[model samples]
Target: MTIGSNSPTRQGQLSVLLAVCLAALILPLSFSGAAMATHTIGQELGGTAAAMNWITNSFMLTFGGFLMTAGALSDVFGRKRIFISGVVLFALASLGLSVAPSLGILNGLRAVQGLAAAAALAGGSAALAQEFEGHARTRAFSMIGTTFGVGLAFGPILSGFLIESFGWRSIFLSGTLVGSLSLLIAIPRMTESKNPDAAGFDWFGAATFTAMLSLLTFALIEGPANGWTSAYVLTLLFGAAAALIGFVALENRVRQPLLDLSLFRYARFVGVQVLPIATTYSYVVLLILLPLRFVGIEGYDEIEAGLLMLALSAPMLVVPLLAATLARRIAAGMLAGTGLLIAAAGLFYLSRIEIGADTMALVPPLLLIGIGAGMPWGLMDGLSVTLVPKEQAGMATGIFNTTKVAGEGITLAMVNAILAAFAASALQQAISGKFNGDEIGAAARHLATGDLARAAHLLPGISPETLAATYGTAFDALIYVLIAITLLAAAVVFGLLDNAKPSEEEANPVVSPGE
Candidate 1:
């Protein structure tokens, strides 16, 4: 019950893992559910493209911004204390989301949910390291990954059923029900733990880093609508740059900085940073992008769209296993580099497909992309640790994990912004100055969301077919950019990781919490 008290039974430990797994289930579901439900959220809530984006960005932003801080808190305070608080807040946020009357309220609740998610993952995973040992600990930790994959693979189908049967609010309601069950199971059995040698809390460093991420994200999301050259956007960018400078200065001076700024000097470590950025555009972006394209632009229902998405997600279940096997024989960089090229090819193939093509026509490219993306999935975390000195492993893990979740949030925002800009440019060129600047900007945002109907409302005489064609063209251009990013990451990884010898640990990655 208290620090290092030791819960003495396998049954109790498993019970605790069940609770963690349940919480894990809610994490990915919340992410994919918001994506699948964004169009519907917009239909009922009435938000601009930038505003509707808050549906996903608000959640990822706070989750990433606070993730490392939450991990440190679990060590200084008590693991169970922090975890239970997180589960409670996560549950309450879900309940609030179920009855949220406006988009503003929904996104606000989502931001709270992200914060709570960070706490739950940090505390729950740390508690596991205390409760189990050796192989049991590995097994327990692996369950978190398995649970996340399951939630992601099934989230769309489940959320679609909830929406069609009970409307969009039910997605959050599902979170409420699961969170309550997790709380009930974990409370009586959970034990507390802490690191007695933990350093003093770095409040200033945390604040500066979070401010930097927040300002940059806001600038990216709002820049397309406000015009990239607008004074408001420029001011936000300037503030973000100032915050970055302040954060770097603080980290350099602090006794125990949040991030080890010197890690940037290592080629392998810098190359490791590219992995998450590559995946965000190559695969993660589509988690939201395809669902919107299918359901919003192509006139498919939730069920139909979810079913089609299976082609994209199903390969993840098995490919990572093969990737791990291959890593034993081949260098991780070569294996993952090859995979990125494969994914890039898939993107090119996907770009060429006609809009509203049949599911059968779409399956090959989507499946190819999934298989390719899954290869690097298990290698990234391992490389992050093995590339650095063994003494610096902890810092490497912290920095890599931050890049993963926080980097993911920022990258998603950038992808959304770029997509909107491309779509707006396409729209403008098609009509050749028929629409005013405000109308063109608004319509472009709508088009990016795959809301051709709302876009039609903005452009009165534009036929649906023509609008769909324009959207497809813009989307194709975005895919080209994604392909370029992926290939560039592959080249960097192959060159850097070549000098680093392969570790046996590469096959079984050691991930941080809230993965």
Candidate 2:
């Protein structure tokens, strides 16, 4: 583990290491690209607005739900075997997804894709950790981190081009190719690795956790379409509660638990973990809302919206590296808290923006958000584990990551619900005296589904100007509420977390458990 005493990597070892890192990087790249192309897919697929959210949620639900179990499975079985299996599954799913004829089929395939991604992501990183040691390993991981950042930063831009040039299907086709290439490299080169001491798989824990998340997400996404108190929504809410209770009980009784409940006792762990939830919620909510604003409301195409998204993502590329340096000088808690406040400032600024604002008007807030997002993703992650026992570091990382993705999935559904409810109500009230109930309902349905043309067709009696104003008012209110929440989260971070400096070891740890 020393710097100079590092053993030289064998000729082909570096290639295998790099391949594993690339495979890991490919998941985020593909997912982000798909997100950028969502508007195009929605237009072609002919689904409700909520269905578009489902496409993303389906992936996140499985990815976050099964991540810990997937990582453990890789340890118990063989990392190479799991990694290649995941690659194959992901490729096949992407292929099927590209040709999927209905939203139902597409969402099902996306769920499969997420499951595959979880396995590939966990196994690939574990393979890299197992294959190299000391300085060589450090460099290998640094490459992995760099690739990850680069992939996220570039994904939307590339997706924008591909979606414009070829179509949305081209996005999945590229993902299939990347998965296939990774599979080919892994077939011959990936070294098989497993933890000999790893215990039995926590099937009960995984099942309960997955069920809990899926149910909660289901209720949120469906609540607006079906009334909030509808039987379906109520059933899902209760089901999620039951699953959560069962998951806690099961994990406590299990021999090798999937989630260690004891770790939550650390006040620092609890406080630092909040940053991920707030940061992830803030980022993902905008990812969905911003594109809808640009394309659905403002008449920009997919390509234009994708390019604009770079303003939000580009800072993520460099800020983390800079923030890591700052970790050595400033307290991790303070750095993360300050970052949250900056992000809050950006969100508040964005809330004041006119609904009809152009791309140029968005850049400053997006930059501030990107800067804010970058700091916590690195700093909070470091601090979360730094205050914990070394033995529990892996579990802590797992929980932190689970929070990030799971929180994103659940919150996205909530955000979608909020938008749908507010917009529908606002539109209904705006046209109350002008249009009949039937016409108002029809227009609301069309608008809610992102079918602005259809809504226009149904609302001939209403002025387009009036319609735009109604929708804008509702959307702006959502942003205003989100701003309040962001600022509140910043306050919590500043008040609750201790201003403790992270150890040098914490700043640049070799292994990230949930990566």
Candidate 3:
């Protein structure tokens, strides 16, 4: 089960190992930038604001919903087989997306790509887990986390370049190439790892769980736009609740379930799942808000905004490795808690940003946030997997991913709601002073749509200088809300987490002696 050990030349196998990890890295990059690109392209193609939301939400819905099922399938089938299938599916989806004639087709393809991604992600981690053991496993997890950090951090900048150089379609075309290459590499070199004694595939549990997650995710993403009180939203909410209740009942009755509902009984497992969700929520919110704050309010263009975002991503590349090394000496919980505190401090600093604030002013806080965020993200997966038995690894990993994705989905909706609320209140106050409420509201709406020029026109009777200052005030209010969320997450990490050290057995479980 060790990587590179059987090869005549260990270095050759190591190369293949690295390539496999790179393949894992490229999957996330394909869709991580979709949020920004979708926002931009949706507006250009005469799509409404809601379309922009769907561009991101659709992918997340499918990706998150299928993750548990995909992981379980890998455990029942074979990791290499699932990995290759996912790569092929992703490649074809990317090809279709590149030339899609309409938003509907593009969004559909993106959802397919997301499903493919879930397969690849689930299989990749399982492959790595089986390929390496003990300390080597720890390093493998760290490497995978580092790859994810780098991909996500650089995805926006890479997307900006592709959009500027070739066009929005080029982003998908590039993904096709990466996916195709990953498949080619994986098929020949990747080894199979399936539990021969694994229980029969839980088809019923998988179907019900997928339905439950899809319904829940749809409600979370759509509720804000449709008005939480709307009949459509209420129906979705009720449907999700019913589906989830049914799923729980089904799991409890099934012989082999996709999710082990009993895992939450362990305090450490609970912390492992909850911590990632909070951290990822904070990460995604910053990813969305920072670009808007920079390009929309501070008047930086796409390229400039991308460059500024690099400040947040750059530290992600290095900090995870540092955290992994630190984990050998310190407890994972301590590292995670410290990282959260550092990220909170960074968010507090970012909240003080002004409309015309110097771009360089943000560099320090962005670095701190990136470094801090990278640490826990790097270590959490390994920590989470170690908390359960070897046979339950796939199920436990699925639960971990589901929580993180749910956190991400809920956070996106909640943060947007907070921003809208704050912006509306600020607009009302500004109108009472002298500004036109309708104009400011129109401007805010336009700004949200990625059309700054139209937004500018909505400001009346104010000098250019004064208008800039007013917009800065509104932006500051939104940042304050983000600051609050980050602080809350930090508090949870510190107060709830048990700062216990992971045992060797906990870190790497042995197969049962009888087995």
Candidate 4:
């Protein structure tokens, strides 16, 4: 059932590669809807800000924790078998989520969905890496990147429409259709790629690694919410540190470790691995903040806001295809580094937005951000695995995926905390100011609707105008902080990375069973 480099079945293998990549897109679609739904529902359910945070954080924790294990299993067993299994599990979980009766049940199902997604994601990348080589492989990776950009750009808009038309439940049900299609394509087309000589599964290593990752993510996400110095936070943080040390020690001694620590010795691998975390950190901050600002503050409906936010993703859809062509001609490191700079510039432009800013005002900044984000999104995976030995491709890909998810999870939580703190501070200042209380209240009401009624009740005193000014200033402050973060990310890229082409010695390292 294995595919040979020059086998007559290569065309069939390519079809399977396409199916696997498309299936990977489904998870993001489902997830984008679920994340937004949870936030909206949490607001309705009287859940505090922290509860809203967990809706996405929980899924990310499970997704990031299992990636290494999934990649290890793909290398040990077979990518096709694991991918099919994952699609089935993912569909079932979506069904469970569609019928979930409570937030607790829904959250549990989301965690399961993340686990299944990790399996599919890891297996799909491994399959592509195994199925093609050289220029063909580059094209395949580029297309995969394009799908990712399209998914990110389209997921929120599609989800918003579903939620608006049929409620949040429809979002999960829609996933069932996608999962079914991917499974149908997968069964006949995908061929197994198992290393028959690979060592047995490293159950101990997997378990320890998952435990360590889960604890670390949990601490990072929950710490600020609970007060970073709280006893519970401290305990989780210390436990995470200890588990990580233990996991590293176990990997060093294992016959088939989940992660090959030696991969870090390659500069390209390290650069690609860390670059996504920083870039995604900046990207997710915009993803979370913009929609809230547009819909919550600007008086736009969910659907309208979703459409407006498309500005950020539109270039993402187109730029990756262009980047794929560029990667073939230029140094991948230079492309990645240049992409980070472009994104940083976009983030800085977004920092200029004011309280009453129009969608038109956001369009230019978003276009820049989109292009910047898309370029590296296209190349990170290729850069990561290409720098490692062929035998260790699965491990390298898994690490790359893990870092990206970890970045998204930690950044989402941190950005939310920052925005909440700023908004609350602004609201408090508005409330405490000396003014005709009735007049100030009226002004607040008018601003909420994004309108200025002619009625006398709509008019506000000088203090109310000051309050309005304060809110705008607060939002601007947060944007500045985000801009600084993006800049720092770009600096990290330029400082830490080298501009060398990937080498054959690094790409085909020695195989030790699961190596």
Candidate 1, residue 97: lDDT:
97
Predicted model with the maximum lDDT? 1
lDDT of 1 by residue, 396-480 (tens): 5446666777877888888888888888888889987789978977888888888889999999998988888888988999999
Model 4 residue 477 lDDT?
A: 73
TM-score of 2: 0.88
- Summarize candidate 2's per-residue lDDT along 26-79 as a digit string, tens digits: 666666776776667777887765677777889888877766667667777777
Local lDDT at 372 for model 4: 87
Residues 1-515 of candidate 4: C-alpha lDDT, one tens digit per residue: 23335678776876776687778778678656765465456544434345555667778778888887888888898887777777888889989988877677777888898888888888888888877776566667667777777777888798889888988788888877888888877788777887565688888888887887777677666664565688997888788788888888988998877777886665545666767776675576667656655654555666877787788877778887777667656765677678877887887787777666777998888888888877777777666666655666677778888888766766666665555455445544655665444444434333322222211234434343454455465557766776676677666566544444333323453323221
Each prediction's Cα lDDT score?
A: 0.80, 0.72, 0.69, 0.69
Candidate 3 lDDT over residue span 456-492, tens digit each:
5666554545444555565567666656666676666
TM-score of each: 0.90, 0.88, 0.89, 0.86
Identify the superior model by lDDT, candidate 1 or candidate 2: 1
lDDT of 2: 0.72
Predictions ranked by TM-score, top down?
A: 1, 3, 2, 4
Error of 4 at 482 (Å): 3.4
TM-score preference between candidates 1 and 2, better one: 1
**Which segments of model 1 are wrong by more than 4 Å?**
1-13, 129-142, 264-268, 381-398, 499-515
Q: Model 4, residue 71: displacement in angstroms?
A: 0.5
